[model samples]
Target chain A: METSTRVPNPFAKRVIVVDWGTTSLRCMLVEPDGEIARETESSRGIRFIADRAFEPELMNALSSWFDEFGNLPVIALGMITSRNGWIEVPYVRCPATASDLADGIIQRRLPNGADLYFLPGITDTTRQPFPDVMRGEETQILGFGLDKEATIVLPGTHSKWAKVGQNRILGFQTFVTGEIFALMSEHSFIAKAAAKSEGIDWESYDRGVRVAENATAGDAAFLTQLFSVRTGMLANELKSEEMQDYVSGLLIGLEFRQARDCGWMKAGDSVGIVGNDGLNDRYRRAAAIFDLVTVDGGEHAAIAGALEIFASVKARSDAA
Target chain B: METSTRVPNPFAKRVIVVDWGTTSLRCMLVEPDGEIARETESSRGIRFIADRAFEPELMNALSSWFDEFGNLPVIALGMITSRNGWIEVPYVRCPATASDLADGIIQRRLPNGADLYFLPGITDTTRQPFPDVMRGEETQILGFGLDKEATIVLPGTHSKWAKVGQNRILGFQTFVTGEIFALMSEHSFIAKAAAKSEGIDWESYDRGVRVAENATAGDAAFLTQLFSVRTGMLANELKSEEMQDYVSGLLIGLEFRQARDCGWMKAGDSVGIVGNDGLNDRYRRAAAIFDLVTVDGGEHAAIAGALEIFASVKARSDAA
Candidate 1:
């Protein structure tokens, strides 16, 4: 859905949405209305690109596209806009709109006669301890659509629990759930026993979710509940093959419980689950345990979001 | 302190208590009354003991002590009694006494003509999701003295919050607080940005504890709070050097909060902090944040516990 009744595709031109992050880069030829055509990806992420030679590396990666399509305007998102990336773009503070992000969009002309635009991330100043922030996720949340009021969960290494309403992103909080799960799965005592698991064991996974729900509802054993992944095995309740999914379920479940505690949702509230991190299914199941209705924000929200914001930027420039 | 009014040193012999865990081995030549005459530690924990060659490894690690003492009795605690170790001794259920541990001891004749005793770990069956278990800690708790009823917090890689009363360990729960902290410190994004810091920044650490205390006192954001180490840095509230201690305080603080949530502690209550993991100072600081009194369990709690349990075993067999 188009966020607000903004002028549609004000530039009426095709865009090459570049989702460049720390570890990988993906470029997509997206239509004005968010239809993605031929795409290419590489391991040449910002981290791998040395000496800040991002321009040449990007040019080389898109050399074929530039040759065929004649310098299509490029829109870069994700960590490419971070302090460590090609250019450090300032974050637009929430509650933010597509136009707000468009206003913050950094524009530069490419040597190949293409216009380059970098979208700024967003931050929540009201978050205690410090302002909570996200780079690519704000755009991803924007892609998730802001036509209706609801809680949107974009699950990833650093999962964001965001509030979207009134055509703006109200605020959001970050949960290091995935990173914790990955760390435990690879480097912890849980990792030692969970070795050689083939795939997700739904039964064990659901059991984990149940444990988290029970703990959340009754006792506050979030830390103790984490130890359950091991305790369950010692009790002959969880098998080695099931440990991974069990830990996965438990971590995601805790994320949901924590999110609820932070006032993002209640049992009866509907929440939109969006992200390309492949954790949506698990998150959907987790939402079920919390009595939350899941609204599917289709894949390609990043592409949709980038396109929409780019069109707004073009409209503003033309008006100027 | 002696756990109860038990007969002292029934065998009238000095002892060697071996705290062999997953990654290291600590052997102490302890006098009958728990005085450490000499000690040695090695990287040769259970994981490094190849081909089940634990006997040879121990002999080599303690060759000098054996040469000097001829044949002191050896008592094994920690992971050495688990399934992966030399012998799979079962865990004694909670509400266990020193005598129960003594009765569960598995004795073997070493090559040096010394009696080797293995103390069984303890498990709380009432812990939801599954039984919570702790190796070596039960003995340490015993060493902490069970005569007075009190809640003991043993901080470690897998910290144990145990209840002691009537000369028996009533029940306990395990929190992987230390493990999570280590994992985040060395592997997570927090580790990435937190480079080159020496010593604990007490002020930063206190701020982290405050964050956890506030989260516990008001809302639930354990996962979100973990991200504060990063957010605090991004906001310039927490300097890079302070990140480590801040995370340390936050993790231990969450452990306390979770323990209280699990009904193990409360404000105005005096809790004893016991363990060999060198985390008591931080735990004490965290306890203060929750309005709880901290009682130092001293450094040699493990040695005392092991000696006391060993003494009980000797008394039992002699009586039999």
Candidate 2:
């Protein structure tokens, strides 16, 4: 009876933050102090949730957490809020803050007596030819903080370079760097010659970064520079095992170069690198080479962003 | 016996030229006037010729030509001369002419007692980090003729930008534009969203070209500009149907931009578009947008190059 009884604390303020993406589902139960109390995850992402079975899938994934923590409010982000997900939430256009993001949050109720909030992604309408958009990264950027007028980079499958100032995300751009790197490394002519290895070759990587940083005319051409990977191997400059890291450095370096060209950051400026996609180190390394001082961004920025937006939305609802 | 009779003429001077590649084999019975007398092609490329069966496969592919032409010398090029091919021929270093290419030829006698010359690929040793090598493109560059001092672009999976002057290929750079386009359009996030269509949308393509042609400091960065393809769709500026051609234009245009950055061609300069990959039209269009005049490079440049290199080698052999 004692074990079965709900042991409640005066500081108990529990909530569920669900970061559901196209390929995976992850739910984190946050305690009063924003520490993750319990976590559950699965491959049953929005795409994998069969025939609009989002409710059943969600209930199943969070059943253990719910059984432990009671009916906690859930704040959802990522592809789960996209057109393909449970409900299509419209993007909140930038220059936006946590409150603005909260205002854009879409709400629904689950059968288990819990409120579900789907966070809206962000869009930069000023981008040329079309508006640039970010799904989960905008939340991470928000979590990274908006008080500082600095450039923030959230590197992932589609890397983002954003300008944050005045407690708002001013504008942003996406670079398909990770996607390109994955494609080239996994299924390309470049992939064929690479010797698989788990360790990073910093020397080869540094050489690749320098190639990208070359001020000589024609040396900065990215497409042409890619050929140097193969040529480097053939010329015995880069060994087979060094190919992947070298390519990684080259790509990340180019991202910095392009970001610089786009006025994201200058030579001496500091950049905030958000997100934990295992690419932050490479970005940091590249930033250092490009004369940038990289600032530490919180790893839990996504959760913080979700919590802030949800609280603001709940406040507005209570006020109304 | 009458059907087996060889039709001989006084002007029947001919040679067998084989463009043996990774996935296919193409043999041409070339007349003395540089015309193709008869041709045969098959899937029996170097890769398919198992267990060092290169001779048997070569004989089978050109048996009819061999029987009719009676011991004509064969000139082979492309991947057939690569390390994985039948015989690994070393690359001829730039700035090379037909004679230099001829000197690099690796000769072997076929079992049928006919001469076989494997034309070496060209390597630009002066290229940064490593030497840049091209197998068949060098021959095509040769075939495009060394009579004029002009920049020539050979478009394919690995497109080339070469400068020719004083009857030689001065130096060159390789842009993996075609390969990148193929990978992105076939196996990327861009591929999933694209609505497949039989016809190309030229207007969308031109818009993409203009995006790459952006004089704005940020517009010219290829990695950032690539994101526009996705953004263009999200903002309804570009439809899913137009994604392919638009991406194509953006990539090809970037190649030209990068080539220009490398000093391949200046504004208002005439450059030759060589090779017939069905992509020449797009390249020509891109060239026009960049203010470069497109000249017709010989369609039979590969064959012409092989023949000239063989002739030069044979002449040098005689003199020696």
DockQ of each: 0.66, 0.64
Question: How good is the docking of model 1, as DockQ?
Answer: 0.66
Candidate 2 error regions (>4 Å):
A1-12, A314-320, B1-12, B314-320
Fraction of native contacts, model 1: 0.76
Best by lDDT: 1
Predictions in order: lDDT: 0.83, 0.81
Please give, as one word, the docking class of candidate 1: medium
Worst 10 residues of 2 chain A by lDDT: A1-10
Candidate 1, residues B193-244, lDDT tens digits: the string is 8765766789988888888888632244788888888787777788777888
Best by DockQ: 1
The TM-scores, one per candidate, come to 0.94, 0.93
